[model samples]
Target: MNSPYSQKIVQPDISLTICGYSKVLEIVSNKWTGLVIYAMEDGIIRYGDMRRRIEGISKKMLTQTLRQLERDGLVNRKITPAVPPIVEYSLSGLGESLLVPMKALNQWTKENYSQVELARENYDRINSGE
Candidate 1:
């Protein structure tokens, strides 16, 4: 009954343990989080700029996601004293490290998305006939 895909999701030792895996997934599982992280990758990003860059994100959701990322130490929030009290965001050291893997995953997704969609279509067609 053993299958490669059924293997343990998290290793007991090294890299991502069960708890670590859960946390990582919890953060990256949300589409908004990944988009937010990607938005901050180049350099410090302003809240308004982020909204413009990430199309379809609501103001509330972006705010919520940023707060979560700041709480997780994955992003740094900077507030500058100004007329409106300018707010900006940037990736923390921890967040910067995550990009190495995230970028690789992005590349993989870009390369295989078509294949994945085809698989899904085939699977749906076969199952629907049953």
Candidate 2:
């Protein structure tokens, strides 16, 4: 039986000119990266504060996501010289630019989450032969 939810897959055009965008998407598409960016939207935040604010993220995952964002030039990392190293993170100009679109996306998700969850439940029930 053909499921109504099933559709033909469309392959994306991955030419050299457009492929670079994939790298940007790869950076932001992770589970924790967007949350980290949103957490920093208020202002510069220390590592501990960010970790506490973003629940369910492990120390290792947060560290890795921050490092990746820094490397991609979306985030700035500042290290203070002190007995206990004080490391802080904030969005760079490029990162700030992302906030507008990210905020729109966040708003859309908040508005549509129930619809999305219902769709998911429907899909699951249909697939499960229930």
Candidate 3:
């Protein structure tokens, strides 16, 4: 029996179990993906600039995140020939669509940031018996 997700008219080219949670995980499970998206939302579109914007993220992590975003068609990578070399990363048309949702999420974070900080402090205090 074909699953509901299976194509009806045009048969799917690939067969796999892609649950909703799994799909969401694939998009935002990475620690750096949200940060990368937020950074891009600010109009900075260069590799070095991104590196600086997202502090503490190693080159390898950023490279991996960029590759994933590119593969997912959420980002565009442009290579420019110069005295040395220049590479840039920017959001694609589809990716810009994500800005609204991301911005909303950011707003929620800002609203709850203080509560989260207090909770962390309380947890630490209780655990430390202080």
- Return the top candidate by TM-score: 1
Candidate ordering by TM-score (highest first):
1, 2, 3
TM-score of each: 0.84, 0.81, 0.70
Name model 3 segments beyond 4 Å from true: 1-22, 117-130
For residues 1-130, could you state the per-residue lDDT of candidate 1 as single tens digits? Answer: 8896687767444444457867678878888999999999999999999999999999999999999999999999999999999999999999999998899999999999999999999999999977
Q: Can you list the residue pairs that collide in candidate 3? A: none
Worst 10 residues of 3 by lDDT: 12-21
Could you arrange the candidates by lDDT from highest to lowest? 1, 2, 3
Model 3 TM-score, 2 decimals = 0.70
Is 2 or 3 the stronger prediction by TM-score?
A: 2
